[model samples]
Every structure is written in C-alpha cells, then in structure tokens.
Target: MAERLPAGRLVAAQFAACAANHVLPAGIGASAVNLRFLTRCGLSTARSATALAVKAAAGGLVRLGLAGVLLLAWPQTPRLSTTIPRNSLAIPVVGCIAVAALAVALSRPLRHRVGRVARRVLTDVRAAHGRRSRVCALWGGCLGFALLHAAVLIAVVRALDVTVPAGHVLLAYLLASGAAVLLPTPGGLGSLDAALVLTLTAAGAPGSAALSAVIGYRLLTGWLPLLPGLLVLALLARRSVL
Candidate 1:
C-alpha cells in the first residue's frame, strides 16, 4: 500500500486509521482485548495518547536543545539562516544524519538499556499499577509527523503564490509550535492559531491570507485526522476491536 502511494504516506495513514479506530475514548471497553498480549507480557496498556504525548514532549525538548546549541554558536542568526530551521527538530529524528553518524552507539544501546529499565520499573509496580507503560520511537514519529505538517504548510504557502523563503516558513513553524507547547489547551488550540497569525504576519504575510492558510492547515492536521480516528473508534467499539 505504501509503495502504491507517494512517500510512504499510505502506511502512515493506515496505522493512523487503525489507531484512531482502536484508541477512541468510547472504545475503552474494547482496548483490553487488543492490548491483552502486552498485559499478559506485563507491559503498559494505558492510552495511546500517553505515548503520543510523551513523543510531543520529547520532540520539543530535543528540538529546543538542538536549537540552543545552534543559537549559541551563532547568536545573531539571520532570519534567512537556513541551517537550524531546516533541520533543528530533525536532529533527534531516527535515520537522520545526527542519529546515524553521531549517536549511532546510543541508538543500539538504548534498546537493551530501555528493556532493563522497563523490567525494573515493572517489577516495582507489580500488580498495583492499573496503567501500562507506553514507550514509542518518539523521535522518529515526531519527525515524520512534523515533516508531514511542514510539507502541507510549504505546499499551501507556495500555492498562494508567495515568494517567502523556506527558512522563514520553518522558523515561523518552530517558534509558533514552541509557543503552542507552552499553553495547556489540548493541542494548543487558541495559542497555536494566534502564533500562526503573528509569525506569518511578521514574515510579511497578510493577516487574512495567513489566517486562511493556518485554518486550512489545522483542518488537515487537527480535525481531518481526528474525526476519522473518532469514527474508527466508534466502528471498532461496535465491532469490538478495542
């Protein structure tokens, strides 16, 4: 399926659809069955959002950490500087240059190390804990998701016939996304919307145009992804795929 589609998108979409079906809030009753194997193996069976949330946090921290290093080395980074903005968030991403040539050793060591840590943690919890642990390949997932989001944004901006540099677009996304993390609202509702307006406007995008772009992007990333997921949950609940 992924081979039939461009850029492995179908595979991502398929996992997303399946997860949405199984992980809906109403599917709480069904989740136990789908996750029974993990439970039998004595692993975490809590919310899928738990792993995704951790991934988001890990993504922010890793990107911020990388940005800090770059900013220190070149304090007065020009708005046009292409180095960090293009790849800052990607530093921790799996299969990237940083993960390969740089942290090759850590990547291999983490599996064994994480397995040991997971066992120790589980040992302490025993039967008392109701929720299971949810550890994912967070760095890679976030990078992939972010890339998908960025691709949409770039496509929109270019579709609008704008000549804005890619650096400006990426910088706006990173900064706005950083602000989105600060707010407590689910998925940075109001804050992210505002940040998009402000960042794009600062980059000379007209308020109305930028607002439209942001709204469109949100529909794709937020509502579009979520609604189908919700439906999947509903259908799975009715069919018992939880």
Candidate 2:
C-alpha cells in the first residue's frame, strides 16, 4: 500500500483473515478480507488485486521450486503413482485449454479484463523486482510459509514416533498441498487429508501412522486457531479495522 498503515492493525488483519479462511472454500474469505484491508489502507482495487496476484504467484512458484529441488536431490523419494494412461491425461489437459480459449474468444468483457490484469501484473512484477526489500519480503515470506507448514507435519510425524525421514515428510507435504489446491475445499478439509495420507503412505509410512499425522496436522492447523481466530476477527470488526 502507498499509504502507510499501522503495523499492529496489519498484523491483526492477517490473523483475522487466517481465521476467516477456513470458514470459506479455497481461501476466498482471506482474499476478500485482505482486499478490503488494502483498500482501507488507501490502495485502488486494481493495485490490491495485483498485489494479491503477485503474492499467490510467488507462493506457488516457491512450492513448485522446493518440490522440484527435493525430487532432483533425492531421486529415491516416492512419487505419486497413477495407473491412468499418459494419452488419457492429455484429454483433460487439452479440454481445459480449449475451454479457456473459447471463453476468452467469445466474452468481450472477460477478454478486456484478462488483458488489463495481465498488464497490471507485469508492471507490478517489474516494479517489485526493482525494490530489493519488496523482493526479499515476497519470496522470503512465501518460502517461510511453505517451510513452516512442512515443519508442522514433521513435528507431528516425530511425535507419533513414525519412521519416515524428514526429507520424505517435507516432500510429501509439498506435493499433497499443491494437489489440494485443485479441490478448493474449505481449508482443504477432505481433499488435504486424503492427499496427505496417500502421499505419506506412499512415502513408506504405515497407513495408521499417515492417518494419525493428518489428524494431528489438521488439529494444529485448523481446529487449534479457530476460536482465537474468530475472536480476533470479532475484535477487528468491532474496532473497524476490517
């Protein structure tokens, strides 16, 4: 934001948004809250949206980069096995591309909006790269975010006395989390649990241990902060910070 905001309020806003995220699907709640906070802090809607886009893009790239690096360094790490034919996979991929192309071709407003957003994102990316502090904050925050989540899973695994290696646990978390994005469930509810269990089990942890890890992870990440998060949300609302 160009207009300076109080750091305390900014932190509160983030806490409130994190709590709000689990109540809605695919983080819509968090995005809406952040967008509102940015606007309240005096940014235009387009700029706020661009900022969010940059953040999301950075986080996604970091996850992908980490997974790639881990896979390369530890080639023995288990990968998700699928029996689906390679040829069959192309059908959905091509269909998605075709559908997107057709929609863009036929919808004038959608095309204009997409073009505008693309231009804004490019401009913001260049501007962000020029600022060393901005670059550090963006990538560092994303990397830290991913690592913290992985640490939680690792802690859970260790607590349960499971025999999975830390590298395998981290790799499994990254892959499962990346896959969970496709489902768009609230806090990745069912989708994350299923993917995590599968990935952990595939990584050679026993089925029982993998399931326990998922439960423990969910309890920490989801159920634990919920009430306090809601309380913080209420406080923010009362203080008119949101």
Judging by lDDT against the true structure, name the best candidate: 2
TM-score against truth, every candidate: 0.54, 0.89
Give one digit per residue, the lDDT tens place, for model 1 in 27-55: 33223333432233334554233333344
Residue 184, model 2: lDDT of 84
Q: Report the lDDT tens digits of candidate 2 across residue range 1-242.
A: 22346788888888888888998998898998899888888888999988887798789899888977887878765454331122443465588889988999999999998898888878878887887777887899999999999999999999999998898889888888877776788888898899899889988889999999999999998899888888998998887777
Model 2's alpha-carbon lDDT is: 0.83
Instruction: Assess each prediction's global lDDT (C-alpha) against the native.
Output: 0.53, 0.83
Candidate 2: residue 32 lDDT (0-100)? 86
